[model samples]
Target: MSVVSDTIDWFSDSTHWSGDDGVPHRLVQHLGYTSLTIAIAAAVAIPIGLWIGHTGRLRGLAVVSSGALRALPTLGVLTYASLYTGIGIKAAIFTLVLLAIPPLLAGAYAGLESVDRQTIDAARSIGMTEWQILTKVEVPLALPLIVGGFRSSTLQVVATATVAAYIPGPGGLGRYLIDGLALRDYPQVVAGSVVVIVLALVLDGIFVLLQRLALRNRPAPVRSTV
Candidate 1:
C-alpha cells in the first residue's frame, strides 16, 4: 500500500511532467526509437522475405535465420555493439532492428506462403505478370499476416527500447526503472513499468483495429456450388 501511495504521489508530482527527463519527453524518445527500428527492420526483412517466398528458394535459410535472431539476447547484442562500435543511439537502434527483423521476415514469408499456389497459377493463366500477381493477389491477401508482423515487431521494439537508457543515450520509460532502482525508489520503478505497460497495450489495440480493418477488405474464398 505504501508503494502504491508513493507511485500515485510520483504521478501527482507536476515536476515530473515538464523537464527534458519528463514522461512526455521520454515517451517521444521511445516512439522515435521504435519507429526507426521498425522502419529499418521492415525495409531489410520484407523484401528478402518476399523474394524468398516468391521464388520458393532459401526457405530453410529464412527459417534458420529467424530462429537464430529470435534466440539472441537483445542486451547481449547491445553490449557487443556498444563495445565494438561505441555506446550511442546507433548501437541501440541496431540492436532493436535486429530484434524487430525476425518477426517481420517471418510475417512476410509466411503471409506469402499462405497464399494458395493455385491462385498464383490462375493469375498466371490470366496473363498477369509475376509482379502483378504478387502485388495484386499475394500482397493484398497477405496483408493481415503482414500487419501482424508489424504488430509483433512494434510491441517488441517498444518494450525493449528501454534498453537505450543503459547505452548512455536517450531513453524511454525505462529511464524510470533505471533511475528508480539506482535511487531505491521502488515506486518510481513501478510507475515507469505501469506507463510502459499502458503504452504497449495502446499500441496493441491499434494493431488489433488494423487487423480487423484488413480482414474486412480481404477477398473471400471462392466456393463451388453443387
Candidate 2:
C-alpha cells in the first residue's frame, strides 16, 4: 500500500531521526512531561488515599472525587488550562496530573483496603503501633496494587502527553499527529503513532516486571482466630 510504503520512507529518512524535531528529542520531551505529571499526581493523591485507607475516613469523598475526575474530558481540560495559564508546559502538566490522579488514588486506597483486616488486627494485637502496622504490614502487602496504579497512570499520561503539542509548545510524538494533519502528511502521523505505541508498550512491560517483583516479596497473609 502507498500508506505503508510512505511510512517506511518517512522512517528511513535520516532527517526525522536527528535534530530538535527528531524522534529521540520528542520522546525525551514526552517522557519529561510524563515523569513530572506522575510525580506531582502521586505526591498529591497517594497521601490522601493512604490517609483515607488507613483511617477509614473520607472514603466516600475519595470515591466521588475520583469518579468526577475520571469523567473529565482531557483535551477540553487542557484547552481551558492553557487558556488560563498562557499556553505552555505548565498547563499541559496540570491537565496530565489531573488525568493521572484518579487511578493512583484508587490504587492506593484499594491496595490498603485489600490487605486482610485480620492481618492488620494481628499486627495490632501484637502491640504494634498504628504507624508500624501501616508501614510494616499493610504497606508491604499493598505495594503491588499501588504499583499497578502507577502503571495505569503512566500509560495514560504517555498517551495524553501527545496532546500537549496542540498548544503550540511542548513536543512529543503527538507533534507528528498535529503536524501531519496540518501538512496532510499521513505517513508522519502513522509513524508518530507507531512510536507512541512502542513507547507505551515498553513502559508497560517494565511495569509488569515491577509488579511481579513486588508480588514475589509480598508478605504472607495473617490469619486471626476471631
Candidate 3:
C-alpha cells in the first residue's frame, strides 16, 4: 500500500513532469533508441531471411543462428560492449540491435516458407518471374508473419532499452528505475516500470492492428460453381 501510494504521489508531482529528466523526455529518448535499433535490425535481418527462404538454402544456418542469438544475454552483451567500446548510446544500440535481429529473421524466413508451394508453382506456370512471384504473391501472403516479427522485435527492444540507464550516460525510462533504486526511491521505480509496461502495450496494440489490416487486405479465396 505504501509503495502504491508513493507511486501515485510520484506521478502526481508536477515538478517531476517539468524537469529535463521528466517522463516525456525519457519516453522520447527511449522511443528514438528503439526505433533506430529496430530499423537497423530489420534492414540487416529481413533481407537475409527473405533470401534464404526464397532460395531454400542455408535454412539450417538460419535456425542455428536464430537460436544462438536468442540464447545470448542482452545484459552480458551490453556489459562486454561497455568494457570494449566504453559506455554510451553506441554500445547500447549495438547490443540492442543484436537482441532485435533473431525474431525478425525468423519471421521473415518462416513467413515466406509458409506460403503454399502450389501457389508458387501456379505463379510460375502463369509465366510470373521469380521476382514477381515473390513480390506479388509471397510477400503479400507473408505480411502478417512479417509484421508479427516486427511486433516481437519492438516489444523486446522496448523492454531492454530501459536497461540502457545502467550504461552511465543519457538513457531512456530505465534511468528512472535505476536511479530510483540507487536513491532508494521505490515510488519512482514503480512508476518507471509502469511507464515501460504501458509503452509496450501501446506499441503492441498498434502492431496487432497492422497485422490484422494486412491480413484483411489479402485477396479473398476463389469460389467454384458446381
lDDT of each: 0.86, 0.89, 0.88
Each prediction's TM-score versus the true structure: 0.95, 0.95, 0.95
lDDT of 2 by residue, 1-226 (tens): 9999999999999999999999999999889889999999999999998888898898999999989999999889989999989966888899999999999998888888889899999999999999999899988888888898999999999998888788888788899999998999999999999999999999999998998788895566422100
- Give the C-alpha miss distance for residue 207 in model 1, angstroms: 0.4
Model 2 residue 194 distance off true place after TM-score fit, in angstroms: 0.3
Predicted candidate 1 versus true structure: per-residue lDDT over 16-83, tens digit per residue: 89888788988898888899899999999999988987888999999998899999999999888888
Best by lDDT: 2
Q: Which stretches of candidate 3 lie over 4 Å from their true place?
A: 219-226
Q: Tens digits of per-residue lDDT for model 3 on 99-200?
A: 999989988888888788999999999999999988999888888888888989999999998887788864889999999999998899999999999999
* Model 3 alpha-carbon miss at residue 152, Å: 0.5
- TM-score of model number 3: 0.95
Worst 10 residues of 3 by lDDT: 217-226
